[model samples]
Target: MRGSFRRYTRWFIAWASLVALGGWLLPPLVNVERYRRRLKSELEQELGRPVDFGAVSVRLLPRPGFSIQNAAIGEAPGFGDEPFARIERIECDVRWRSLWQSRLSFDRLRLEHASFNLVRRPEGGWNLASLIGREAPARGGTAAGSPPADAGGPLRLESEGARLDFKIGADKKPFAVINVAARLDLDFTRGNVNFRLAGEPIRTDMSLPTPGRVELEGEWTPGEKLSGPLAATLRTEGALLYDWIPLLTGRNPDLYGVLDLQADLRGSIYSFQFEGRGTLRQLHRSELPPPADAMPATLYARGQFDARERGRVVVESADASFRDSILHSSGNVEQVFSAPQMDLVVAVEHSRLEDFFQLARRFASGAGAAGLSGRLDGLVTVRGPWREPRLGGFFKAQQPRFIAGGTTFPMSDLDLRVNETGIRLAPVRVMVAPRVELVAEAVFRPPAPPTMRSKQISAPSPPSAGEPHAFGLRGLQYDLALSAKAVPVSDLVRFSRSLGIRAAREVDAQGIATASFGLTGKVWPITPPAWHGQAELRGTRLFLPGLTEPLHLPHARLEISENRIVVDPVTAVIGTSVFTGRLEHQGGRSVPWTFNAHTSQLSLEQSALWFDVLGHRPPLPLLARIPGIRSLLEQRTAASSLFAGLNASGRFSVATLTYPSVTLTNVVASAAVSGRTVQLGVESFRAGGGRGAGDIRVDLTAS
Candidate 1:
């Protein structure tokens, strides 16, 4: 019995060894080339395309699978000879049990270094339509239908180093995706698919003009009727947006910026709902003019879009933020692919003024910038037919202060309202000093289409054919009213200096003055509108160096008109002399201004007041140490050369004059100045019982 058992065991071991050896050697001995050729033909018939391969190899040990090297699939008939897809290497794994049942069921597929060229024929049918067992429907839609009978079972697909190109007719599109990697699972039985896809990193391809990367995860249930919801989350970060802008707009803004977006997508393939938050950082133009301090910003949006309507977007909520300022808005934009139309309301509440200046500085051109400080609250509504935009809004400043040159103006209540036609400002009251208050009100209207005045031009001529015509300069009109109550002249002098005007620094003015002015005009016209006002000074005392006694004005009144100002009478008391004068000065710039003065009595020692007001100083440096010259030299610098650009003349006469000890009667003089030249004619002079007349000329061209 033992011998028999040993014989059986030997036989069993020998059979097992033979079985293992056969399993290992069968794959090498089988005619895999013939099977490969047959399988290619089967696939061509099933896919309705031509398939070709370089070589094929079979494996039998771990699992039944095939590997093909250098394979390609030809395009559909009439779609050109260019292969639709090509692969350097392809691998497929099949179920072993299914092979015995005469069925080829792919369990796994992988491709390396593959490329696909998809085309849309002139007849509006895609090369891939037949592969998916669906006829091309109208537009981008698919017809309702069940899955084809040949639709395979569930499978997993993976690919690396893949490229995809698209073409319409015979022309290649501008966009192509390169260096793609993806893993996907398709369950045809359950009609569901899930995938993870990633594109090449930015700047990895030198041949690509616009380089970018996309990372996405998506899942969807494809109903039998080809209508169902899909959802995806994607992240795309790239430097491609700058290049893409020109493709649509026909002009490159040459912007240097980085764009990054994280978004969620939900809806059917035909229409989608999107929610996203993104940022544009370090945004500025590189080759053209750009703003300084271009602050980076954040953007958030939730909207719905339909693929069928290519140029419309509906934004349910949109928000943008730069620094401490935020704009919250919602609107519908139409024809985005062409001439866009927008209707939106942007609002901000409780925002800092410094943040607003950060945006305003971009538009400021010079030292005139109103560098303001405080808080702001505002709302702006913008509506557009696109070409003709209309804007309306209002903004309020909470305790705003403007700092410029060297002075500060604290405005307690400032409000601004704007509309399509004009702008209005609320009355503002400012405190300049302990006892001084300034009140101002203003309204401004922007230019409208040229309105023909019967005297200006014949009624607008009709545009000639093929000739472009534009509206003439219409005119900007403004109205401003200002008043100052109980203010000292010293403060006014300081304010003048802050406005780039020179003033006497050696004089100390006392007492209070009240002034009011109103101006209305079309600033664009060569001749501005009329400006008239009045001023009054009461109990004002002025003291200067070298003067033993102060000069006092008990009362003074001045009247203004469109073309000139008239001082009815100004009586000044100096020492034992009293002088009264009526002065007239021409105003406005359409013509040269002139001055005339007639005085009943005058004190020569106090003549420096006229020189001070005229921004002039006598050439006497050493005399400054004697108090009189010091006031003239140290009070203000030499008069500006602005006189060289002005034309002026003056006439003056004094019936009686007192100078220290001498008194002159019937003193009359006339002066004329033009472009660095001065002329003075003494009509007559009587002093010390002698009378004389003469003319003096001064050439100040070198001075």
Candidate 2:
């Protein structure tokens, strides 16, 4: 009995050794040339395309199969001459148990270094739309619809380091995703499958960012039309900004950022929904960091995609949050790849204003968006083409403050808008203490994006019908309009100086002044804005340089321009002495000044009281509207000051001049003024009811 057991064990060991030796040695020796045609036929029938391959070899471990090299699959009809897929190597493992049941099953198949081209025809149909789902030729002489002996069962296929090229018809695009590792568990008999595709998307443009892997795992059941119900979970980290932005906005913008997404996907591969949390951050322009105090971020969002619907995309919900601020958006983009038009609604609820500025800083430019804080809320609709979108609705802020030139302008409210015209901040209301309550409106325009122009240079251009108004495209232009009513003169003067305007400073005034201006320049590069406006004053008293006390002025008007200042004819009275005068100053601080005046019914006592030197008084009661007018004037006159240079040679007449001792009627005087001296020759005078002719000079600057 022991001898018999030992014999059986020895025979079993010999058989096992023979099996291992044959598994190692027989595969290379076996001639698989005859099976090559059958394998090629099977692959062609399965994929419904023309297939070619190099020599096939037998496999022995785990299961019986074949390994083929240099397999190539031709493109479908009407897609030109380019092939569909080319693989460096292919391995197929047949299920032994299924083969014993008279059915050949491909349990596993592997491909290496494969490249595939997917084309979408100009008429919106995929190239592979009609090639799949057709019944294959029966094997082993079996009739159609009858199961063949070589019928294959489920296939678990995998590819390592593959590439997918996207094409519109025969023209391949400059976009492809590479380094793909994919798996497909396909059950041909049951029409059910599970798949996983992971790849890194890249842009072939000159600026090539580091691509990141995006993964999708899903289940699919292909129907007759190749339309299948599919579901998947998609994940990606550090993807290119251009790859994702073109999905919503057709054009690829010049921007820099990283994108991360995690989502559950459902529906068909051609049309599907993706609800995800997406985060974008580290934004910049051409790889430059954001401003020290600001950061660029956002768009954690969700949306839908459809390949068949002209690459249509719908933005169902997009939300981004930073601390207590929230911004939500929803919109749909149609014809996303060609002639894209967007209709989106964005809502902000207590969102940070700095966030908006940060985004603007990443793109082109955001003028006047610095030093901004506070909550912003709005419901804005963005429509039309992406190049020039029309915005309806407004973004507003409450009690925002801005610091400029060492002054904080406390704003009561702000309203901002963007339309086909440009970016506008209309009616930014301010109520600053010690200054005026002002309403400022501004429009900022950067160089517009290039647009397609007509080939004919002489073509008549179409007139742009205004949207009430439009800030024309191109140029670095900033226009500002400011208006104020019943504001203090001191504060107004201070504010003008802060804006780098030449303003009044010598006199102390206490009257309300009304002012408005329209200015235009470039806010960037810090250009001094050119402005034209007018200021009006009424029912106030101010010091005149030639007089010692202030006079009551019924009306005063000033015409101001970029380089000139004009004080129009003004009417004033001092103790029933009516006077009128006009002064003009050109070239700002260079001080080319012109002054002229005439007066009637003047009194010598008033002249003596006004024309005396500083610190020397005539002892008459001083009457002035603005307090400290005399002291201010005296300080200005003490030195060779702003009023030192005067050249005057003119003739004028005062209808009446009178004193307590005598009265002169219809007196004509010739005046000459140079430096600090004024000589007026009384050529003719009517005194004591008689006419007297002489040259009488009075020392008006004396005590």
Candidate 3:
């Protein structure tokens, strides 16, 4: 019995040894092709989509592994065409035991090149939604739950070298590119995914297909639902502004700005905190289409944003300073975003208004050259889920000065409020002199249509004159009030001189004036139309030094019509000269204004004084103390207050201001307007000792 047991034991030992030797000599065994088919089947079942592969290979070396060449996972059609991301090649180093543990341990995943089409659907959904077997429900359906089962555990992927292309819309134009050759360290256990893309400069193209060199290093965690704090630094070079300019203005912008950006962001999906700084060097505008000139070089900006809540985003601070230029701005803004609602408040300190005007003139016309220097405070609010946003705000500027058309008007304070209706200005006080104060309140609407033209012309809205219900005008409505006290009219003349506007002569005079009116105008919807109420001007001690002698106009009541002006009983030293006039505007290449004025009971002495003050002095006699007046003052008599019924017709154009042409026909010293021309008969008058009277025909058109 002992011998038989020994034999059996020896046989068992020998068989066990043979089995151990067989395991040691053979490699780690794995059905790689079977695993690949299983993976494909599992992905199809999980994603509810077909999966295809160009080639599948398995390796049984140190550990079981597999590789797929040109693998494609199908996506929904309506979402986008190129939904399946085709990887050039994929090699994964995976641990088989870990797969049973509901985990994947991949030593590395070498992906050569791939393209992903990330599309934002018209209904505001994502194309990637179907990849995880999660389809967004129709409008009325209940919200979807968490991620679907069989979604496959986190993938521990480390890319060797790869290129990624992204497209949007139907055209499938490449909007973004990511040339990635990075070392990705992923730990599914800790829910940490850290990656660093380092190579011969990872590049991308956005907006204009211009290559932008970029470098990225970041860490992310998916199990934490991106809630874990993340740190990344991205460097981008050769970013162009002209590429995105067309988005702002339908036309291609002539802007040229290169970008050098550095960003540091750390945040979660719920709330984010970021601080970034970028420099724009060599900023220039080569050729603007119209109404815009080339701009100066400007330094970019640096700013920070922090969001603590879901709906609130705060601009911790931001600053943009100009280089070798006059513009400088630093501000802080806060924004609240809620469903169908948004509100923003901005406060700018040490803002230059002149620089602001320069920026504005690029898109608008009739913008005067006025520099602004002060603190700017503004608040804007938008409400509702409407297609067009409704906005309202209030902007205030302190101590703003305006320099336009040769005039300098220093405004003490300017405050404007914008509502659903239009823009209204608070009472503004202007300082023209030490004691002079000009207070004004106004509302300005935009110009009507037909004033501006674009490539596509739109029809104007029908007039509302016959179908008015409650509103006044369709576009803009305004009411203005202006008052002045102790203002020197001579200062107006001085201001005009600076504006290059011709002034007869400078005069020193003080007066108090007040006017109130209302204006209604349409925006540039179709045609520019405006209607203004009458304005009344009252002045006292208004002196005119341009005359041969100082003259005072105590009071004047002027009525202005569309094409006519009637001054009723003007209180003047000229024995109350009353005048009525009509003006006609001539359009086209020349801006000519035609006027006809009839005057009566005009004092010759006063008229002569005006001419002398205007610097249009007649020839002076050698023996006379007063220049040019020796012969004029010598005139005799009780008839000194001549019934000089003067009918004057003349046309004045801006081009003819330098060399004026004048023609006076059928002039009578004491006559009235009998026809188209003034019927005036010259009367004899002596200045000092000379007397002369003759029919004089003055030709004003002859230069």
Maximum-lDDT candidate: 2
Worst 10 residues of 3 by lDDT: 651-660
Clashes of each: 2, 1, 39
The TM-score of predicted model 2 comes to: 0.61
Comparing 1 and 3 on TM-score, the stronger one: 1
Model 2 lDDT tens row, 450-536 = 363222211122223432232322234666777778887656655544444422444445567777776766543335676667778
C-alpha local distance difference test of each model: 0.66, 0.67, 0.47
Cα lDDT tens digits for candidate 3, 251-361: 343555667677776665345566667776545443434333434333344444444443454444444555222333333333443342333333444565665556544
> What tens digits encode model 1's per-residue C-alpha lDDT throughout 180-251?
897877665556668788875322222325536778889866553334668989887854556545544444
TM-score of each: 0.53, 0.61, 0.48
| Best-to-worst ranking by lDDT | 2, 1, 3
Best by TM-score: 2
Q: Relative to the unseen true structure, what is the Cα RMSD of model 1?
A: 12.2
